[model samples]
Every structure is written in C-alpha cells, then in structure tokens.
Target: MADDTSGLSVPPKKLSHSELKEYAPGLQPRKMTAKYEKQKETLLRDRKSIQQLHKQRVHRGQSAATQKYESRMERKKIDREKKLYPRNREWKDADYFIDQYLKREAQMKTERVRARKIQNVEVKGNDEVMFVARVAADFECSPKVQKIFRELRLYKPYTAVFLRRSGENLKKLALVRRQIRVVKPIRQQVEDLIRTRGFAKVDKQRVALSSNQVIEERFGEHGFVCIEDLADTLMKGDEEKFNLVTHFMWPFKIDEAFNDQSNKVPGVGRSAADSGRHLQDKVEQFPFRFMDSLMEQACRRGKSRHWMGPELIKALPSKKEAKFLMKVKRKKVALKAKERKIQAKFDAIAETDRKVARKLRREHKQQREEKKAAALASKNKSWKVAMKKSAKAKEKKEAKRRGEDRRLIAMYGKKKSTAKKRPPKKQSKVE
Candidate 1:
C-alpha cells in the first residue's frame, strides 16, 4: 500500500529545451539564435509596417516604388489586353464618350425598377376607371422623380401619357402629383391620343400610323381591329391589353393649358402642391376637361371627315384650288402693300404738319421774348436821353447867370471885371 501511494503521487517531468529542439527542428538554437529570432521578428514587423505605409502612399500617389510597380503591371496588363483585343485597341475621346453613354443608358434601364411596386393590385367592382396625365413642364425634378416621369414617358410639358389607377402607379404619380394633372378619362381624349399623337410598334420600332391596318396586323391576334378598339380595350381595364397598347403608343404632345394662363406646373420653382387649390380640383372645375379642350381644338383645326367625303363645299384643296389660293394671296399682298403705302404717305404729311406747327409756336415765343427785350432797351434809352437834355439846359442856365453876375459887377464897379470867361466853341464841342 505504501509503494502504490508513492508511485501514484509522482508528477511527470517537464520537457527540456534540448528535447524540444530535437523533436522540432525549427526550435533549434544557432549562433545568435535569440538575436536572429529577434531580428526576424523585427524584420517582419518592419515589413508589415512598410506594407501598410506603402498602401497609404500608393493611395496618396506619393510612392515612387508603388508607381514603378503599377507601371510594370500596367504594361503587362496593356500587353495582355492588346493580345486579347487587337481590332479596336486604340482608345479615343469618342470611345470614352460611347462607353459612358452605354453605361448611363444601362444604369437608367436598371434604375427604373426601383419605384415602389404594388402587389395584388386589382380593379374592383364599381371602381371608377381613370388615368393621370402630366401637365407641368418642370424637368429639374429630383433624380428619382425624374426617373418616375421618364418611366411614364412624359418628357415635356403638355405631353400626356395614360396611367392606370393601380396602387403602384398611384404611388409613382403621387411623387410627381404637383407637376401632373389627374383627370377622369375622356373617351374622346383617349381616341385623340391614339389617332393623332399615337405611335404603333412596327417591327419593334415606333412608327406613326398609316392606317387601321397597322393595328390589325400587330394586335389582330388579341382581337384589336382599329384605333377605336384599342382605345376601348384600354378603357375596359384589361391589364395585359392596356399595357401593350400604352407601350405601343408614344407620348402624346398637346398644347399649353390655355393661351393666357401661365403654366403653373407644380415642383417647378416653389411648392405648388401646397398652393390654394389642388390641381385635381382645378381640373374638375374646368368647363371642359383639360384633354377634352385640347381634343376640341385639334378637331377644329383638323378637317372634318365630312369635308373629306364626296361633298364639294369645303374639300381639301387640290392643285387648282392651291393655285387659286396663291393668286388670292398675291392679290391680298398687293392690297396690303398699297394700304401700307397710303398709310406711310399720310403719316409723312401728318409728321410735316406737326413739325410746321411746332416751328410756328417756337417762333412766336421767340418773337414775344425779343419784343419785350427791345421795348425794355428803348425805355432805358429814352430815360438816358431825357437826363442828357436836362444836364445841358442846366449848364446853359448856369453860364447865363455867371454872365449876368459879371455884368452886375461891372455896373457896380466893385471887385473889377474878374468877370467870367466864356468857353471856346472848339473846347466845348456842343454838337
């Protein structure tokens, strides 16, 4: 029992450095082994530090060593690239521009998917089927808002595009609600949209309609025979058919809302969304719907189908009618020229008469001013003459009195003839 206790109590000895080195060759110490390991650690630390510093310097473009390495790598990469693509290996400004353009277009196509999507959208029973149209021409919207407009194909002011009343579409329209006008779908307007400003997809290209045959050819399988049928399909809320027709149709360009009214396109400069009257309210208050008014104007401007019929009261002008119109235009032009000539002559005579009247008035004023000045000068001259006459008379009377005094002195015989000397005629010069 005592020997078992001693054996069980004994602990294992730790391995010596020699034994560790013998088992693991890497653990063996050489000359300056500690110093070497220390130096290795220091070298590794310095290398890591250098690598970090090199990364920073490369980012700052301040590392010559990194620059050289990049240049070498670039040369190798260029060589590889040249081997890979030798046909159009030369890069130019135009190539760069084309690359940028393709990139931007691809990015735009991808970015269009980010608008809010509505799931399980439905057109329930008794729900009014309506479409929204953009009326404002503000293109300086936010990127997301502009992308929404671009997706809707409303590129300019008064360009109308039909929008379904789906939740997703409603959300998209709400983003640009201030700039757009929502209205009750007018059948006439929709027909006009398809007839005049409509484009159909022909061979995957947007081409204007030549006849109802184009629609029949493309949508005949879907039972759309003409423009009216297509418009009817859109109105019935058939999602698949509606999307196809809208996609085939180009954006409809219309005139401004009214002639005199300024285009109060919301989101242009100020927040028109918060303005006094909502755009929808204003649209509802209009005498005719915005699009209907536009359609009316278009109908008036376009010749009637009746006029295109067999009747000859107001048919489209033929060559003979065109010549007659030209002759009438020339005669009208001659009459206008004569009227302008007569008006010019009358204007010239009136202008000359006005000049004469102005000249007479100015001469009369000058004459009155000159006469007053001459009258004042004459009065002053008369006063000067009267004073000169008075002075001469007084001098003559003084001379006579002096002579009488001299005669009295002579008669009296006192103070002798200290008498008076008369002035010589030449010295006096009394003329």
Candidate 2:
C-alpha cells in the first residue's frame, strides 16, 4: 500500500483549521451571522431611489399628457353627441333637404293628378258624343228601343231630334215603325191569339195563297211592289193609319230590326233594353199554371215554397231584405256543409274503430302465440332439468353397484367364481 501510494503525486500540507480560519475569516463558521443585512439595506436604498425617480417621472408626465388625452376623449364624445342629436346643424340640413324633396314630389304628384282628371273629363265627353251618335245610327222604336230612348232622354221635353238625311232616315223610319207596333191594340190581339191557340199549334199553322192570288197580290200589271209604295198607299195623308193586324205584326218586325241593329254595335243601353224586352216576352209567354202546380205540390209536401210572379209585377226588394236573404242562404249552405263534415267525421270514426279492432285482434293473436311459445320453452327447460337429475341418479346408482361388485369379488372371487362355473361332460358320454 506504501508502494502504491509512492507512485502518486504528494499533496500539499493541510493547514490547521484554526490557522485557516485566521487567514480567511470568511471561511470561519460562527454561531450567528448578519450576512444579508448590508446587502438588504443597499437593495432597499436602491429601490427607494428608483421609486422616487418613478414618482417624479409620473408626476411630470401626468399633467400635459393626461390633459391632452382627456381633451381628445372629450372632443370625441362631443362629436359623437353631435352625430346622434337631430338638433345639430347637419341633422337640420338633412331635414331641410328631405322636406324640399318631399315638396317637389308632392307638386309633381298634384300635377299628375290634375292631368289625369282633365284627361278623364275629355274621355267622358267623347264617350257621351259617341254614345249619342251610335244611338242615332241604330234608331228604332220597339218596346225595347222605346225604353232605351226614353232612358236616354229622347222623349224628354228638352230633347232635339238630330236626324241625318242619308242612311239615318231609314233608321228613323224603322224606329217609327217599331213605335207603332207596340200599340195596345196589337198587344191585345197577340195575347188573345196566344190564349186561344197553343204556341206549338200556332207555329205549325201556315198562311196559304193560290198562285193566281199571289200574282194578283204581288204584281198587278206593275213592277214588283216596293215597300215604299205600300207604305205610301197605306199611310196616305198620314192620318194615323192604324190596324190591329198591322200593329200585331209590327212588334215582331220592329224587334227583328232592333235585334239586327243591336248585334251590329251592342254597346250603350240599346242592347240592354232589347234584352229586357226579350226577357219580358219570355215571361209573357211562360206558363204560370205550371209554376202554380209546383208551388201547390211543394205546399202539400210541407215545404216552404215561393212563386215569383211576373217580373214586372214583383215588388222591388229593399237592400236590407236582399242582404238578409243573402245572409240566410250563406248560413244554410254553411249548416249543410257542417252536417256533411260531421257525417264524414262519424264515418271516419267508424272506420278507425274497425281498424283498431282488427289491429287489436292481430295483436292478441300474436301475444297468445308468444305466450304459448314461452310456456313450451319453460316446459322444455323443466324437462331438461329433470332428465339431467335422473341421469345423475342413474350414474350414481351404477357407480355404487360397481363398487359393491368389486368389493365382493375381492373378498370371495375364487370360490364364488368356481361355484358359478359348470363342467362339460358330454364328450366322455359320446366316446
């Protein structure tokens, strides 16, 4: 060990601990020390100086910079307030612009309305003149024509006839003829004939004239007889030549002329008046007895019935009565619709019930089958357990018997075996 230590370099002599402590007081250990006191004091003094400098800097910066920031914020707030308030100058300017625009728009609208009103007036005046012209062109004096002309103020005391010389003369003459046809005498004759003979019988009947009579009647040594000639011959002197037969035939001819004229234009009150006359004729020709029979039958059935008499004879309905009937009909229709809806609901309920019952039956059948299956499964499980138990018991019994047999054989195997064996002596007997 001395030799191994001799190969290593010698270390320097270690000084005594107390001599080292005297040389380096810093290395000396003491029971108590104030090592951090001076450093803590220096650090606290530095911190105090830094704090004072920071406070002076804050104080110096606060006045001008804070004032500048506050002034800027206040200016921004004032600008925002101006933007929001309507009393500001900008808002007033916007309002003035809007008001001016609205005034201009309203002025333009007024001008448009006035222009439209003037145009409508001109159009109405033109329409009236055209209406008058049309009526003059297709002048007739059938009951329908009379009614239209009367409605148009043709028969008024202030009315002035404006007859044209050319084609209008024929139209005026046609009107005159129609007027003459509506005479009371002609109407009475036609009514009497209608009452005496049915419409079908009258329609089937025809007027017949022999060939000589036709020749004599149509052309008696002169050219074809013109309507003007007949009119001149018949209305000579214009002493109000009136005949019952002519008056009766006149209405039909007048109606035909009116119808033809009406078909041409079909505007104004003329066509409407013609339609009214046609309606009147139909009403006059209608069988009242049939309506009476229907009413009587309805009355017998205990149902309320109304017989609408001749249209001309019926009282004009008041607005209130018409409104009331309309309301009543609406209510009746609503009630009928409600009843139908209720019937449909009942039918739906019945159908739903039938479906529900069918569904329930199907469910019940399925449930029964499931229950039966569950019972069968449970029975099978029980049978399996019983079979397992029986098999276990049988195995135990067999094991017990085999153990007993082994013990018996071990105790009396040779003697029991010899006694159970049988000798064979049949071979000696055969020798």
**Which prediction has the highest lDDT against the true structure?**
1
lDDT of 2 by residue, 234-296 (tens): 332122222212221211212222344333323223333344344334433422101122112
lDDT string for model 1 (1-431, tens) is: 35634423332376677775555545445566787899999999999999999899777776676889999999999998766767654555886779667865754563343232212233122223455566544543457667777888887655666766554554455345445655556777678757766777677787887589888888889888888897787787577778888887776544433332434543323333332133334544332354321122222444422221222212224569669989998998999899999999999999999999999999999999999999999999999999999999999999999999899888886564576999877766688
Each candidate structure's TM-score, on Cα atoms with residue i matched to residue i, is 0.33, 0.22
Q: Locate the minimum summed-lDDT window of 10 residues in model 2.
A: 122-131
lDDT of 2 at 130: 8
In model 2, which regions exceed 4 Å deviation?
1-334, 353-361, 414-431
Query: What lDDT score goes with residue 404 in model 2?
Result: 92
